[model samples]
Target chain A: MTEQFVAELRRRATIYWEKHPFQQAMLAGELAPDAIRAFVSNRWYYQASLPRKDAAIIANCPVPAVRRRWLERIAYHDGAAEGEGGMADWLALCDAVGLDRADVLDPEKVLPGVRFAVDRYSAFAREASWVAGVASSLTELFAPDLMGRRIEAFRTHYPWIDPAGLAYFEKRCVQAPREAGHALEVVLEYARTAEQRAACADALTLKCEVLWAMLDALDHAYRGHR
Target chain B: MTEQFVAELRRRATIYWEKHPFQQAMLAGELAPDAIRAFVSNRWYYQASLPRKDAAIIANCPVPAVRRRWLERIAYHDGAAEGEGGMADWLALCDAVGLDRADVLDPEKVLPGVRFAVDRYSAFAREASWVAGVASSLTELFAPDLMGRRIEAFRTHYPWIDPAGLAYFEKRCVQAPREAGHALEVVLEYARTAEQRAACADALTLKCEVLWAMLDALDHAYRGHR
Candidate 1:
């Protein structure tokens, strides 16, 4: 049943945002310069939002072991101190793409649609079961493949962007699968009932839709530019 | 100083969503049939979201008096029973607009942008001080005028929509000022410091921006249709 459940979760890859036309255009190097800036800048909202949701998960979880593991996820993106972690890496990417760092961090720079979609992640973590929160993080399972392709695409097509800015994507290529494995272990152990497993599957679908919806807004906004 | 502070909050009317072009087009009765549907459909997300945010404020609030008062706002929207209240009236609006009731309630039908903007209110309510949450609800101060005008607009321009569907607006025209007055008393009593007053002002701005941003997404999506 667990194997079948995991497989059911994997089937959702058919709708994974990696298949999104905006992402496809991105990997194919067809995105305009402005579109690239828009992605990096707007995406900063999601990058910046990660640690808050992780903190929510930690706040809601009762188990020390679980909280300890979740703390690492927060630190992974937030780093040991300010100016250090994945968020900084994303800001660097923004800088590499010629977007002002202030603007990237500015709430005004984020599309209401993108902010809406990303805020759902935080709300889900705060409102759902801790196990379900972990399940939502299963988007990591699909991230590595997209990261690998993105790195290659950037290197070959968007060579004008500095290599250093790609560190966030590069690190995720290694970090995501490990995190996904950890999250899957937690979900499998806790989400034992058929109903719980189904809820986790629904959470995964919500995560995927959150991502796809973010791009839907971007695609709508940048259609003319693209 | 309190009068000045209240005056400052009132000044935000300039940026209130009543001024959004889409809203302007809406009140002017210039919106196409498709635009009206998009407006009603997407506005449902915001209407539906109101009680949840109010609940967040109530949950975070320790003051029973405040909670008692705020609880009324939730009941006002959600009604005493499921089939009553503003939500049911909104479903009627949806009916008037030709959208299916189930589709109006479906999370999938909501624009991510609209959802994002609306979700921010909940997050703010959960994360900020209870007093700040009341300040955020100060958008009620601006709602009655818009509601009155909206009723007139629908009666004058879009007579195709059933008059019954306008009940939500008609009721809010009476309800909003009373609610806003109560919220202002809370803000005036609690936000005594200049810094606290400024934060309340900022919260009001955030609420205004939330309303504006919801329309931004709708405007972008239905621009050509309009």
Candidate 2:
């Protein structure tokens, strides 16, 4: 049953990739400022909502110290001061791409699929076992490298934007690895049974699909607007 | 304004602390199996569901490579193999201290505050703006040190449990800092305005209070019995 689930999740990723417009653009070599702007504007909902999920994880921890450590993640994303951190940088990204900050934050522009995928993830956090919830975050393990590639792509391929405007991705170059390393240790140490291992795998696949699906939604909405 | 908010949050923490009975014990050196057991069992809901929250975070990222890296955190918590991350270890601690896993997962047995706190966090995640949502996760910056203190306390003050059983806190010795570091970088780099900075602070305070309140509630509910 687990194997079947894993296989299905894998299939979802493949299909998602093939049909996703953003993926198509990257492959076909035509990622314009419009696409980047659209993507950032649409993804505002995601950046806005993630920490509370991290908070749930902290709250569930039995140990104060563990909870405290997890809780720090909340602060980091929140920023120590005003107008700094990845979230702010992301907002800045939208601004750089000519998005109206107020309209973007209004969150009415987000597509249904994007909302559904994110809401499903929230439900997963609220509904799944702690390990399963944490397992879903395992995707962080792969983020640093990805963020690096993204920065490179942005710099080399998309040069219309100011260098400072790309600070959000720059932040990830340092942040993703730090976060993923800790999470990886937790998973490697906590999954104590075969069922757990399978669940962990599913959690990763689930996250992957959700991510892939978001890009799919963007691609769907973004088709030929330029 | 930021200082006022921080002060307000701290004041709330103070009030919460003054009213909390169990925290008094931990502070006054009240370490016992029953107290620990209560804490562990009640915490199951939060501990078990964290990865799902992380999944939400990853699912929401705009970039593909970013999504992939973020997914690793889910795998860590959900675990790829047996006896690995924080959740399973927490359950082990519960069993060691005399908790029934069924009862832990069973809503009927959990304290109302536990349910409320966990659910509120989910709601916050669901409702917060993208930046606000990510900002809320900043609490993890402080996790590693707390985890360190916990392991030593268990090893030094509570000798009834096996060293092997202490693996949960022990494992976090490495995990907390790594994750916290990444999250901090993201928040610091992304938060771009004073208003957003303040918002991030509030989100973190809310997250911290949620955690502290859970302990407060537990202390109030179980002090007499423990």
- Per-prediction DockQ: 0.01, 0.05
Best by DockQ: 2
lDDT of 1 by residue, A1-226 (tens): 8889999888765588988989999999988889989999888888777766775665455444555466567667766555677777888888888898778868987999999998888789778887888898887685668889999998888988998889888888888899899998988988999988888888899999999999998888887765
Which predicted model would earn the best TM-score?
1
* Deviation from native of the Cα of residue A56 in model 2, angstroms: 1.6
The candidate 1 chain B region of ten consecutive residues with least summed lDDT is B59-68
lDDT of each: 0.82, 0.64
The lowest-lDDT stretch of 10 consecutive residues in candidate 1 chain A is A59-68
What fraction of the reference interface contacts is present in each model, in order? 0.00, 0.00
Query: Candidate 2's residue-wise lDDT over A1-226, tens digit each?
Result: 5445444434433433334558557434476667777777777777766665665555344433344345446556655455755677888888776788888987578887888887777667656666666777766564435566666766776677677878887877777777766765566666667788677778777877787778878888777754
